[model samples]
Target: MKAVNEQEIRASFANCSKGEAKRLALPRDLAEQPWDDLDFLGWRDPGAPDRGYLVTERGGEVVGVALRLSARQRGHLHRGMCSLCLTTHPGSGVSLMTARRAGQAGRDSNSVGVYVCTDLACPLYVRGKKLPDLGGRLEETLTVEEQIDRTRAKLSAFLDKVLA
Candidate 1:
């Protein structure tokens, strides 16, 4: 992924109003992010832990979506898998992240939700850059490149649902 500035990130949002995008916080550590290792930029708002955001290059354009953690949904105690990277996590490592639909539907309060890594670190997990102590992620036959592609596809599909 390419390094992006605050203005670019704010303008890339597809599921929120201009005002909301403007108010949304950009990661304070942009200068230190591992850009080459990222498929997308994702982070939970420091000021608002329930609020999350994701931005990526899709179909030749930069696109972004706003996400909210469904705090009412509890994580499984034994094992859980992130729908995006397919990484297994124990306990509270996975959570239901919801995204408001784009355009008028979003304004009407319609949204979509999926189980994802609590910290939105699917890229790192898939690459084995970061490992949790849970030891639940099963060994896979798929190669690293295949896993990356799969992760990107899953995220794109989710974005498609939001845009729809």
Candidate 2:
């Protein structure tokens, strides 16, 4: 990730209002982030936890969206998956991460949720770059703790960008 100017970051958020952009706590140094492994950047505003956000550089521009927590106990199997990484969390793999919308659009933007991973693996880490296929069962190749750490790493990077 390279450093991004405020103007550039703001422009990426064309769908948002100027006031919303001004209020967001975006990262100042992109170089400090681990861009190689991140699926997307995610963070919660320190001043307003209810005003979390995510930013992904699509094409050549940064696209950010304010987010909110939507914790719901979804039944296993058919629940939605994370918007970034496509992993399933089974009985515990679901959180409805709704996005903050424009003045009037928010009232109807229910579909723009964060769709958190059931394990909530942070997007910055999580071994999104896979190693060679292991020669054994999935459980034998990677321990649960290892799996969580990878996810957390990704999440931390995104959080840093947003909270910075």
Model 2: how far is 9 from its true place, Å? Answer: 2.2
TM-score of each: 0.94, 0.53
- Best model per TM-score: 1
Q: Which consecutive 10 residues in model 1 have the weakest lDDT in total?
A: 71-80
lDDT of 1 by residue, 1-164 (tens): 99898999999999888999999988999889998899999999999989999999998888999999987655466677899998878877788899999999998999999899988888888898988557445589999999899999999889889999
Q: Which has the greatest lDDT? A: 1
In candidate 1, how many Å is residue 48 off?
0.7
Candidate 2 positional error at 55, Å: 1.3
Q: How many collisions per candidate?
A: 0, 13
Residue-wise C-alpha lDDT for candidate 2, range 104-142, written one tens digit per residue: 555454335456653333443246433212111134357
